[model samples]
Target chain A: MALLEVKGLSINFGGLHAVDDFSIKIEKGELYGLIGPNGAGKTTFFNLITGVYKPTSGTILLDGKDITGKNTIQINKAGIARTFQNIRLFKELSVLDNVKAGLHNRYKYSTAEGIFRLPRFFKTEKAMDEEALRLLKVFDLDDEASVKASNLPYGKQRKLEIARALATKPKLLLLDEPAAGMNPHETAELMETIRFVRDNFDMTILLIEHDMSLVSVVCEKLSVLNFGQLLCEGETSTVLSNPEVITAYLGE
Target chain B: MKTKSKLIKPYTKKSFITYALLIAVFTIVQLILNFGKMSFMMQSLLVPLCVYSILAVSLNLTVGILGELSLGQAGFMCIGAYSGALFSSLMKEAIPEAMVRFPIAILLGGLCAALFGVLIGIPVLRLRGDYLAIVTLAFGEIIKNICASLYLGKDAEGFHLSIKSAADMNMAPDGKMIINGALGLNGTPKDSNFTVAFIILLITVIIAYNFVYSRTGRAVMSIRDNRIAAESVGLNITKYKLITFGLTAFLAGVAGVIYSHNFSTLQASKFDYNMSILILVFVVLGGIGSIRGSVIAAVVLTLIPELLRETIGNYRMLFYAVILIAMMLVTSNSKLKGRITAYTNKLKGLIKKEKKGEIK
Candidate 1:
């Protein structure tokens, strides 16, 4: 059985159908990709899947449990985590604290315990800090952990977002345009890092990318979306070479 | 090994000295201030200053830490002050002494306020930004109007006499009851002092500081920074926002209790739109997220109008308005803009330094 299945998902914004009858299924531990030209409803699909927008009609099942129309936080707590196309780090917070914010859901100490500085509060806080540092180190961001997230270089900021998502301990991770703005070298490094995280953490990844080269190199399977419809789906090389996929890119 | 030592060494010594010095100075100044025999006016002003500090700091937890605007503090305070006054009055004859009833009254007042906080927060917290502020402001006005119509105590004829006129009317000493609409409840025990107010203020600051520094605090800050991003990581935005609202209201309620007990009267007019705005100004005038800023602003704003009282006389409010407008302009334009740029530059420099250190 597939780890995630979206069946006949459709969403509308008043008169316009933003995402129409989209469906996709992924097996456990698979690395999948979604690619489309600009204005092709790629992001709208991601938004629907991540619960930023509830579908007007359809069902989203994760590991055989329906999770449609739930709030974004609820979806996240159910073991799905995502990064934005634009990096959305807490700009005013320190790098480590941004990662720690993701660990907030796991905290067990009550407000009373925290206010009184109970030993249990301290223990949990220490563990969170250590876990945040460990994630940052994996992304090579530990050296800049104390600095404000906004001050990090663009590449490092992108990596920090991934690290924060990881801190949520998600079983399935979604990346929205993870390599939107990057030099070739940075993009190549991010590709390897993405692969490394998936293998090391044993996580399933679903990604959206406009950069065909990066998506083609990293994703074993790819789906093509156009005008809120699925254009094609297959192995990366087969789907990329499809005539409809070629026509969509060329027309745009 | 060398890198670890370099990282760990300065934090330990610097933090230890900083904490020790702060404690010593605070204690010493508190001692010196306690020795003075102040006039009634001075005491009244000082008491309000401490009370406002608690209100401003608590409101900041919601507005600054949680990144939501709220205007229902005065409503919560009204709940606290009225409830506290009622509790103390009821227990005065029952309790052996006035002193014994004081602490119980204050606690009861705070708890009552907290209950209202949770009640109002559950619904109001669902809205964000200006929506929440508007709902809260309306709630505050509604509370004040409701309190204005309540007649809690009675007269000799058994007809519910207005609390304001109860003292003037002839009544048995044991049968005297107070609390009237718009007339203000009179003859409440005046037990609130600078020491008591400051102790509560101290406890509030300590609790607020711990909350903002904890994991829950970070979650609140993140929600303030970006609600969508915070929720995407599984932080329950609504739940945390309500928590902050409830906690802030609880503190404001405590301030209300202190105010009522100190003045020996409870006036519904004191908890109105003007008071809520005044507290908001305190939080904004101080850097919103800065605890020290709120405390300092509370003290300065409180003392400034008082210092001008004799000179400006009844026009003290005009002076306050002028200063508030001037500070708002300065802080919004040059001061905060400059600070932001400076802070960004400092963060960049720190990053570079860390990179260099890592290279070594």
Candidate 2:
């Protein structure tokens, strides 16, 4: 069984179909890439899977559990954590705290225990600090753990967002244009980080990117979305070489 | 060494400093009260200083920490004041001891405000920015008007409520009027004192700090910073917002109880739009998201007008306005703020160097 399975997922905004008949099956531990031109409904598809939008039709299954139209929180709890394309981070929070906020549900203590500073609060917080720091260390962000999330440079901010997402311990991780604004050096580092995340965390990964270089190097499987439809799907090299996909990116 | 450093993180040190500031203030006031001759005006302002401080701190939880603009905090305070005063007036004979009755009244006030907080927050939380502010301002006024016209009487037939007039309650001939419309609740127990108010203020600060440092605090701040990202990370947005809204309201309610108990005559009219704005000013002038700033701002701001009252009379408020604007300019100007921060850091570095030298 696939880690994530979507069957005929469709959504519309009145007269316009934002995502139409989009369906994909991601096997466990696969580095999948979703590439398209701007506004090809790539993000809308991610929104649909992450429950930011209710699908007009079809079903979604995570590890054989149907999670179709559940809310964002429910979908996240069901193990699909995603980073935003524009890097939405808790800007005011410290780097370490941003991850700890993501660790909210995994490690538990009631609000009362938190307010009163009970023994359980201490135990859980200590564990969370350790866990959050461990994740930070992986991204080489431990040295700047106490810095505010917004204060980090552009590339590191992207890394911090990814770190925060992984803190939720999701089975499948979705990265939306993770290297959106990075130069070649940072993009290369991000590629390494993405691969490392999949290998170490046993995470089935799916990412949407316009950066073809990052996609060709990191992605094992490729799905090209054009105008809210799946234009092509296959091995990264084959899909990139497809004349149809090329026409969608650079019109004939 | 690692464990020790982990144990005392940056926030822990800041939290200790806040506590120490409070304790230092308390001790200084106690010494002035016991040995030095305190002016009658200054003595009278003590409990009120605590009240305003608590109000400012609680408001900070909503305005600064939760990142919501609420103008109905005074409405919650009004609910708290009335509920607490009513409870104390009714239970006056049953629980004669101030030790027992006052605490219950405070809790009743806080819980009552919290109930209203959750109720109002459900609808109000849906709106954001100016719409939220306008709606909450309207709610505060609505509460004040309702309380103004409220009439209650208790007798053999049990408690009666009427909005028109006290006579509309139609209680038995021997029935006593509790809330005579517009007159407000009168002759309530004067159970609040400087010590009690100070302790409650301390507790409020402690709770604010704890909530900020806790898992829940981080979640609330996350929601404040980015609602979408917070939700994507598995946080229930509505739950955290309501929790923060309700908790801040609860503390405001606690402040209300202390407020009502300090005066023999309790009036809901006092908890108006200006009162809400006054608390907000403390949060703003202190620096948003700075809990320690809220406390100090409340104290200093509250003291300024009263301290100048005898000396300047009418011009005191004019002076107060000038100071408020000056404070806002200083706090808001990035260049000035940076320079201030630099000087403070330099001072701190010097102090650290001296301590190191002493150790060597």
Candidate 3:
């Protein structure tokens, strides 16, 4: 059985069909890529999957549990997490705090305990801090954890977003444009980090990348979208070399 | 090499020593003022300063931490003041004459206000930013209008009437509600003292500090920073925002109770839009997300008008507006960015030095 299954998923923004008849199934621990030309509903597909946008019609089943239209927080609690296309770090917060925010759902301290600064509050806070630091260290960002997230360089900021998502302890991680602005060297590093995170966390990853090279290098499987419809899906080399995908890119 | 010194220089033990010295100065000033046979006017000014400090800090919880602007602080305060006044007045007949009922009444007022906070927060907190501010402002106006229509005092014949029944009666020859409309609620016991006000202010600061430093506080700040990111990470924006709004309203209500009891008089007009704006001015002038700044702004703004009263007289309001606008502009401008950077750098330095000392 697939770890995630999207059956006949469609999303309409008023009169515009943003994503139409999208369906995909991913087995456990698979690294998959969703790619397309601009205005092809690639990001929209990610949004729908992450519960940012509900589908107009269809079912989204994670491990056979229907999670369609669940709020983002609920979806996150159900072990699916996604980074944004644009880095959305809490700019004014310390890097550690930004990662700690991802663990908010798992906190054991009650509001009363927090307000009173009880022993439980301290213990939970310490645990959260340790977890956040551990995630930062994995991303090689532990040294910068005390710094404000906004003050970090662009590449580190992107890495921080992934670290924050990882802090949620997601079973399935979605990366949106993880290499959008990175130099080739940085892109190479990020490709390795993605694999490291997936293997270390024992999770599956689905990433949206405009860098076809990075996608080709990291993703074992690929799905191509065109104008809100699935154009093709198969192994990365076969899907990228498909006539339809080549036509969609060349035409655009 | 120079970079390390630059990073480590500012946050030395001297930084803490300066804070302690500042605290000492404040205590000394407070002592000098309290010891002297201060005029009633001076006492009134100090009371408002203390009360407004609590109001500003509490309001910051919603405005700064939760990233929602609220303009109904005065409304909550009115609720607290009225509740406190009513509770104390009613208890006068039952409680021992020597026992202090003001503290209990203030607490009850805070509780009542907090209850109102929950009610108001449920619907209003669903809205964001400017929408939340507008709704809260409308709520404040509605509360004032309700209070204006409420009749809670004795009639000419010394007979007490329910506010609703009193409203149904024709206006007396003097155009008064026969129950004090616009004239204000009178005969409330003046039980708010400086000690009680300061104690409440201290508690408010402590609670706010604890909240801003907690996991939930971080979540609220995270929401403030990026609601989408926070939501994506499983943080419930609505729940945290409501909690913040309710908590702020409760504290505002406590301040209101203190204000009402101290004056021994209450007027619907006192809790109007202007009062809410005044509280906002305190929060904004202090610096958003800075509790100490809010408290200082509250005290300074409260005292500034009074200090200018003799020189500016009725024109004092114009001067106050000018000062507030100047402060806002200055704080928001790039000029203060240097100071803020300096402060943060100093703090970072101090933390590093402390860690190094502990390592040794």
Candidate 4:
């Protein structure tokens, strides 16, 4: 069974159809890509799948379980995790705490236990810290574990966001413009990280990227979106050469 | 990888320093009270110093940690003071020991205020920023006005409550008037002292620090930073907000109990909008999201006006206003704040070096 299956997904912000009739199936451990022109509803589609926006008409099934119209938190608990286009980190928190916050639901201790310095609080906190550090080590952010999130360099901040998302232990991961503001060297690094995440964590990744170099190198299957509609879907090289996808990009 | 024993968590170390500071102050006060001469004026300022410090720290939890502006702190304190005083008055005979009864009263006060926190938070937490501030301001006024005209009395028959004058209660002549209209609760036992207040203040600091370091605290701070991102991460934003709001109110209520027991009469009029604003001033001057700063600022600011009253005579308030403006300028200006941080870091380095040399 596919990890994520969206069928007849549609949403309208007043009169404008922000995402219209978007449907796709992503199997477990597959690297899927969603590419689109500016304002072509790529992020909005991510928002829909992650339950940021309620679909006007649709069904989103995660491993054959219908998850349509659930809120963001429930969807995350249902095994879908995502990162934002503009990086969102807990700015006031340390790098370690940022990942630990994502590990919140996994580790169990009551608020009262936390406040009272109970034995369970110490045990769970120790476990959480170790797990958070492990995730940070995977992203090579362990050395700067105590640095505030806002103080990190741009490239590290992007990596930290991904690390935090991974800490949630989701089956399906969505990356929105992961290489948005990177130069060629950093984009190269991010491509390797994306593949490394998919391989090491056995993650099913669905990412939106405008960087074709990173896209073609990383994504096995690609879906092109234009004017809030799916323009084409196929193997990466085949869809890149399609006439409609070309016109959607180059404006023939 | 660094060994766990070698690495001290930054928050844990910082909180230990706060506890040490509190202990040092407590020692100095007790020493002066016993061995050295202390003016009557200075003696009276002791309990108030602890109370204001507690209020400031609790308010900081809302304004600093939770990043929500709350003007209803005084309202919560009012609820705590009245409820706690009422309990003490009713149970005066049943539990005659001041030691046992006062602690229960303090807890009761805190719980009463926390109950109000949840109820008010349900609707108020939905509103953000300036709207939340205004609504909370109104809430304080509403609580004060409600308590002002409230009358409670107990007789052989039972307890009677009336919002009108004391006469409207129509209690039997043998009954005792616990709360008189506009006069507030009278003859509340004076169980609060400087030592108990100091202990409570220390506990408040510990709770505030612990709450900031915990997983639940992390969720609350994340919501403060970015609500949508926090929601996307599967943190229940509402639950965390309510927990923080309730805890903040609970601490404020604990402060109210201290305030009520320090005097024979507990008046709702004392817990006014100005009182809430005064505590906010402490939080702002200390530095937002800074627990240690709140405690230090509360102590310094509370003592300044009173200390200046004898030294500067009628010009004391004018001097206090000047200090307030100066502190605001220093804390808010990025350049000044950076310079202050740099100087403090340098000072800390020197202290560490000196301690190492002494040990050697």
lDDT by residue (tens digit), candidate 2, B91-180: 999999999999999999999999989998999999998888898889888988899899999898899999997778888889988898
Predicted structure with the largest DockQ when compared to the true one: 2
Alpha-carbon lDDT, every model: 0.84, 0.92, 0.83, 0.92
* Worst 10-residue lDDT window, candidate 3 chain A: A125-134
Give per-residue lDDT, candidate 4, residue B139: 90
- Better structure of 1 and 2 per TM-score: 2
Instruction: Give, for candidate 1 chain A, the lowest lDDT window spanning 10 residues.
Output: A103-112
What TM-scores do the predictions have? 0.88, 0.96, 0.89, 0.97
Q: Write the per-residue lDDT of candidate 3 for residues B26-54, one digit (tens) a residue.
A: 57757878798666787777667778999
On residues B1-360, what C-alpha lDDT tens digit does candidate 4 reach at each position? Answer: 473433336778899999998999899989999986899999988999999999999999999999999999999999988988888888889999999999999999999999999899999999999999999989988998999989999899998899988888989999989999788899899999999999999999999999988888889999999888888789999999999999999999999998899999988898889999999999999999999999999999999999899998899999999999999999898999999999999999999999999999
C-alpha DockQ for predicted model 3: 0.53
Please state the error at residue B340 of candidate 4 in Å. 4.3
- Ranked by TM-score from best down, the candidates are 4, 2, 3, 1
True contacts kept of 4: 0.66
lDDT of 2 by residue, A102-149 (tens): 999999999999889999998998889899989999999988888889
Evaluate every candidate with DockQ and list the scores. Answer: 0.52, 0.72, 0.53, 0.69
- The interface RMSD for candidate 1 is 2.4
Runs of candidate 2 with Cα error greater than 4 angstroms are B1-8, B342-360
lDDT per residue as tens, model 4, A1-252: 899999988999999998899899899999999998999999999999898889999899999999999999999999999999999999988888889989989998888998899999989988988898889989989888888899999999999999999989999999999999998998998988999999999999999999999999999999998888888898999999999998999898
